[model samples]
Target chain A: MKTAKISNPSIVLQLDGLTKKIGGKAIVDGLSFDIAKGEVVGLLGPNGAGKTTTMRMIVGLIGMTSGDVRICGQSVRTNFEQAISHVGGIIENPEFYPYMTGYDNLMQYKRMTAGVTEARIAEVTRLVGMQDALGKRVKAYSLGMRQRLGIAQALLHEPKLLILDEPTNGLDPAGIREMREYLKQIAEAEGIAILVSSHLLSEIELMCSRIVVIQEGKLVTIRSLGESETPTQKLLSISLQVGNAERAQELINLMEDITIARADALTNRITLQLRQDQIPGLVGKLSTAGVEIYRIEEVRETLEEEFMKLTGGNRIA
Target chain B: MRNFTGLLVNEWLKLSKKRSFFVAYAILAVVFGILAYAFYELSPDGLNSTVDFATGTIMLQAAGQLVPVLAVLAAAGSVTQEHRYGTIKFLLIRAQSRNKILASKYIISVVYTLTLVLTAAVLAVVAGYIVYGGGAGESTWSDFLTNIASLAVYSIVFVTMTFMIGILTKSNGASIGVGIFSMMVGSLLVMLLSRYTITKYLLFSNTDLSVYNGEGPPIEGMTMAFSIVILLVYMALFLSVSFAVFKKRDIA
Candidate 1:
């Protein structure tokens, strides 16, 4: 039996034309992608763009209206148990027995996963910064803390691929930062593939190595971060605090191959778009013209902007 | 087998956490307690009359039926609760086979029902003896044992039916509502249908335990041994249908 091998890059998950429908409307239409081991791939999309629906189909939670999903070379519909054993996921808000302590919840999950030792449980608990809170009932946990425990449970089996949906939804800035670092540690240290879905493209930019963007139940773009050979248009935003911002705006208008928006006196905000190489030259010219540049910082358009561009800005703003 | 045990433990943990469990048990207990008090008050002559003997046995049988009622409620949440909470995905991704999960749930539910029935039967019997001061009431040990055995079979059948209900209906509210309503109204419906003699086989009419006087013809054509066999067959049918439906239903 010749199976489709996705190369030696340690392919953890692959979805082929996964489609789903509910109530006479298609939710996910022919979605496909590949996630490699030790890589964090962000599933970026709008609220109803079918990212979560795709994840659900891949994990065998929802049946596909058509198409297939494979994890670690095992087809979910054909070899469900074998395929699913390599997958760990927390969809939407992670839930547990509220009456039970976080440790007890993990213990129950540990009982179902094979070859996961108690020591491993302790390790993941510490990794998520929940070791001190492991003995507390989940009912008392903040949403961020519960999300950490959710991640802990997902890692308990040391699965080949981990899928988390909107994990940073309710987290404060510090908690979100901790989750970003902790997820990186898991991917790098354990060599597990991670697929995270989020509306925060800045977070995705800081984490994922590759990303799949979905728009209205269809694939918009699949691009690699910091690498891969796709040369899409480069976008840049500039923030300036200067003398006579109107004069600076006049210079920006005279320049070719750039779109500029000037700030009002009340707001003091300016946004500019130009080719990657042109940004420094424009900044230099503005500095030489005695604009008394309080600050001229170059801003790279985040995954969020790229996504908006790819989908023609039809996403939920 | 390890996975089976794990699923069983999961089901037990989940069932124990439900609020309906405590409420159901409390209601059943109050009903039984009221019956015990009434038996003590009405049989002031200490059940010396044959009429008192018959009524006391009927009440015991009524309590026996609660065994099935509680079993249905207890098993009702097995699948539907997970579906409601959107945790079926978590369970599906576990390292256990779906077949094992369903089987473990069925076994644990039947065990729960049987234990409840045994407790209720023993309590009712002790209460009956205390209130009526029986001389074994013209019944032999073999006859009493046979009745207990028959009730055990009935309990298994009811548990299996409840499991099927959980599988057939994808919502806890629907499954529990139907299971309880069936236990209350099923016999009446069956009797109505029994205008055609073939429908008599469908009714769980073996509940008329008072008719077993240890010397009579065992209630027309009813035999505890035969009832046990028929109930087992019915249970097997319900189980097969439930498994098939669960295997085919979409997880979402």
Candidate 2:
């Protein structure tokens, strides 16, 4: 019930040894992370990895069995009002009173909260591009609109930390892109920290600056996205369609700074990972071996493969 | 206390937006109207005890029969629907604590119950006037004042019980089912068990505050003071269980 200590002055949210147990089982165990101002941190985990449970604990929607969640150095266990005062959150899918208009729904939030001005309301509505739809009843709204209105209400108070649980769960490709854009804009314009949870790394890769990977109710890794690597230092994976895959694999295996990642003799296709500078040499070696190279194209390491490496082969839902 | 008024206003707006409340109130209004018309048509001549009929029958039916059902729906729905729709998260994650939020809903449930009771009192007076003219039920005002007062004391206990049921069940259909079932069957069971000494301790037995106003206790040797004390004990039990569970439980 004490305030959690912050290691960095810029940190807006701190979770220290956060845990939740039900029926003598830990749903989220010993989970801890920090989100600093202006950073978009993604909570990445497979299905039932406890992403939703962790978010619920932080926002006080669910009580924690142990440890503390701190916002602006205020403990959620002891000082709930002040601790939650600095947080704006959406748990799971956004829900509202369906019979009320979106505007009235926002007004309901405005009334319960202090220091939320009419101008601030207008700004948040505009921020979400929901100004025109504000007068429409929530029952008449689509899922995407509900998500935006949920964000709109969360932003109305202008908290230092924003937590969104599965923000793009039901959106189409276009709506997902729009949501990602809005999140990026909010983080930059408001200069606040945001924690977004999702099971898909593709969504997180596009939206988050850093990723906190969780597996089986534990932290697997915390990695910064877009780690800066010079073109020479980076390894590129290239799939080569050749006349004989066996000949290409043998030739590529002998080359320096290049390794065969996958070789398929049936399709005569082999994927190789090597430095960008090694591509020309790899091609020359294959050609001299009289292995006809039909096609060679680079392949981005996909979400599945990235997660497989992190989780050691557990499937992400 | 920081935004208690805001919480009240929010809960009121929420209840006001519920279409069922409008449907319930409208149906009550139509039923009241029909009762007035039936009396007007049946008695071309004014009844001798029109004051007794209006307050005792009409007002009692409103407070006793109609108010419990509607008030239970409102009170139970006020708590259960938040859990159903998952808006409870939005309600709890703000600057307001759970205690203040629950207090606001409880207060509104009481306010809503009183409002329904008062509306019935007004409608009863109007119905009596339409049937027998203004001067016929002269004592109707004093009678209704006492009747509504007892009804308030009588129905407030149910409002609290229904609100607590909503918290316990966390489902509209379930809470309303149990609430109305408890009201109807609890009274029936009290009557069936009235000869037993333990019946005096039942909620339904003590809920009728009219015993203090000369209607007499449901059981022998039960005083007005005893009934009041019993009602207080039940209300305290209902409230403490609900508040404790709501404050301590994980919303998930």
Candidate 3:
């Protein structure tokens, strides 16, 4: 796949060596990435992996110890007003005055920025599907509604980049799915860049076009879901059902480039890791060795397993 | 300048929507009504006392003493509520700088306090006329103007003090505690310390500016000009500390 160049004018957010240190330890170390216009990027990391810290630094909620963040070509440190005007974000929970209506909450944000008209407010309310609930006080709304209102407020000014920290947090499965659909619609319809941090991997896999993974404050990998690479192209664990599990395990030990990931004796099933192309050859060898194979299936890796493997078995919070 | 105005408007909108904001005015109305009734019972003849209870000057004097506590409550909540509700993050993320946001909150708080004071003063005057059956006092219009001006200055000092406490503590309870302590116990503390030369410069002592209207200074040898200068100094100090702390600290 072709990587977008640095000179790409569509880049809305660029972080060059962003770093943050607290109490003489680096919480986010030398992090760098760029988000293009109309791109939806997911920030995937375990708890305390510095996703929120990076988001905070981007939004200027906290000072960066080193490096810089540029939004729409304006430096956050030097041109805070101009740079921040081009960006909108919710750092953690999207909090508002509970006594105020959703419209009033949006109005509060509206008054702070320039060129945000009543029409724009109405447009965003409709965009978030919050038009009917705008009159209701925020305290009466559910968490999903609040999140939608928060998105409406963020988009009122038509910012080039939108940053959301755990936008799907505390959401039920249906609510999470709804939020994912809305986010995709916003990104595509408005041509706005979005940077979302979340622990829900399947949601991230479905919602994000690209993913940036970090572990221990360092960049683990950055992958694009849009690429055509199949799951078989990457290392995979395959589960095998056989007539004789013990004999199959011994036969598998004789095979090159294959190792037992897990073994189940009573069920006569074994999980092995190898290249996908070698599965057929392994089966053939096992049958020749008189170990009858009942079933052979590729065990697709869930995002959880891949994340745990990348982070050395650390769970994503 | 537009952003600052917008911030001020936003703060006012939020405050106006709260039940506490209107309840405060309601409390002021009740206090004024009681004061009017008490004055009517004490001077039924309306001619025995040299001081005319019906004049705006008297109203200013009454509110000057009582309304600062209300100002303290309002000003303390201005900053502390945002911190308590974790809503400061929303404001901090805007294009406005921290200082600009804080300045807007501070100025709106002062304006809200002044509005409360003016409303109470007006209520008192109206009640006074209905009870005492007099239109004006023996004092000149200039004396009444000075009284109003001095009351404004005095109330602002308390507002600024409470605002500083709110920013420093970022907790509604702590801000209210300090504000109430300063309003209630402050005078007693100043009275106990009045023997010392520094007592003349204490904030509570300088805050009662009715001395210019012949109400007598809280301390001996304290002039109106001296008290004005002291209050201005303290106001500047409080504002400077508030801005410095707010600007330097990170929003949690």
Candidate 4:
């Protein structure tokens, strides 16, 4: 996969060596990342892994103990009003005046973002599929509807940088898919930089072009889709035509190049990862020994597996 | 300055959206209406006590006074409500300076207090005038209205003071409880102390609007000019303390 070089291209948001300490503990430790225009970056971390903290700093919600945040190359601490003018966000859960109609809530947000017009409000409501419920009070809406309205509110000004923290949280599978697709469309079509943080690995894999994984308040790895080669490991599923599955599996387990595990043997299949060279050797050895060779296929590690490996299986439920 | 005005409009809209505002208005209307009727029944004559009855009832009935308490309640919970609802982070993240946000809320809380208090005052005056056959083409009520304006400033001052305390405490229960208790209980405590000693500075000692009536010795050895200065100094102290504390608090 090819990678784009940084050549002074416009950066909509950047966090340089950001750190925050709360209750004498480091919540965000020397975190750094950047989002250029038209880029969608996923922030992946455990439940307590500082993704929210980083998002807060970028939006100027929480002042960093050290380091700096720049929106559209403007320092938040120095030119807060100017910097924040280009950014829009929804942190954690989107709260509204529960007694007011959804339209009134949107109007309130529009009032916050300068130059927001009724046409723009209508456009955003349509974008988030909330046009029909605009007249209903927010208290009457479901969580999914409220989340969509939150996104609509965030997009009211067509912000240059959009930050959403765990946006798909509490959404059903369909809602999650809808949110991911909507976010990708806006980021790509509108040339808006998006930074979304989530605990769901598969959701990030599906939406983001580049993924930043943070663990225990430190960045572990930054992976771009199809850029870095997945660790040179593949799961192989081998099946035998004859009903000598137990004996064959035992013999294969003795091999040094692979770790064989017993798979449900309705078809007498064994699953394991083997070296590329070991595959040719094993096939020859099996044929020569008169073992039935039904099929040999490699299963690539999914983003979920890679996430487990990168996070060392420290995910929270 | 335009940005500040825009923010003020937003804050005013938020205040109007709250149920407490309407509740406060309803209670004020009912209480003032009842007091208007009672004043007419107890006036010196059947139909000749228009201006006097209006002025007497406004002073006698605590009905309209609830506006200030409601104003304090509104100010007490305004910012703290955002903190509890986890929207302070969202609010602070917007393209507004911290001072602008504080100032907007401070101004809006005062405006809210003034609007409610003025409504109550109008109702009391109108009801009294109607029940007692109206003030007989006199300039006395006009001068009294001017006096009411000065008293209105005091109500505004108390509302702003309560707002600052609310922001400083960042807890609705604590701010509201302390604000009301200080207004009510602190006045009682000061009055008690004044009976035994030389210090006679009670909170309500300054709240009496008729001090300019030239009736009794001033409550705290404070002249009108000195009293206004003390109120200004008190406002500055509370506002500065609120800003200092809020600037240090961690956004939720």
Q: How far is candidate 2 from the true structure (C-alpha RMSD, Å)?
A: 3.0
| Order of candidate numbers by DockQ, starting with the best | 2, 3, 4, 1
lDDT by residue (tens digit), candidate 4, B115-204: 876776787677766776665634357645754665476567667777777787778898888777776665566566665434434444
Mind sharing the TM-score for model 2? 0.91
Clashing pairs for predicted structure model 1, backbone only: none
lDDT of 4 by residue, A234-263 (tens): 445443343456666766777887777556
Instruction: List where candidate 4 sits over 4 angstroms from the true fold.
Output: A1-7, A226-267, A272-297, A315-317, B44-48, B135-139, B195-209, B214-220
The TM-score obtained for chain B of candidate 2 when compared with the true chain B: 0.91
Which sequence of candidate numbers ranks them by lDDT, best first? 2, 3, 4, 1
Which model scores highest in DockQ?
Answer: 2
Task: Give the per-residue lDDT of model 1 (tens digit) for A1-317.
Answer: 22475665577798888888788788888888888889999998777788877887887777888878888888887888888889888887887877778887898888787788999999988888798999988889998998898898888887899998888888899989998998898889989899999888899998899888888788878888976442436565667777767777877788888887556665455677677678677878887886566776766566667777787775453
Question: Against the true structure, whose lDDT is highest?
Answer: 2
**Residue-wise lDDT of candidate 2 within A1-317, one digit each (tens)?**
56547868888999899999889988889998889999999998878788888999999988999988989899998999998988999887889999999989999999888889899999999888999999989999999999999999889899999999988888888888999999999899989899999766788888889989898778889988876565786888889999998877777777777888888999998988888888788778878889998998988776658878888776643
Off-target runs (Cα >4 Å) in candidate 1 are: A21-26, A172-174, A226-291, A315-317, B17-60, B128-136, B201-233
Global Cα RMSD, each model: 4.7, 3.0, 4.3, 4.8
**Residues B1-252, candidate 1, lDDT per residue (tens digit)?**
676677788778777655455675666557666766787677554455333443344243556566667777778877777777566767777877677778877877877776776666566555556665664355444555555555666556666776788888777777778777766676677566655555536636554333454443223566656555666677779989988887666664
Least accurate 10 contiguous residues by lDDT in model 4 chain A: A1-10
Candidate 3 positional error at A5, Å? 13
lDDT of 4 at B8: 87
lDDT measured at residue B190 in model 4 versus the true structure, 0 to 100: 55
Q: What is the C-alpha lDDT of each candidate?
A: 0.74, 0.84, 0.82, 0.75
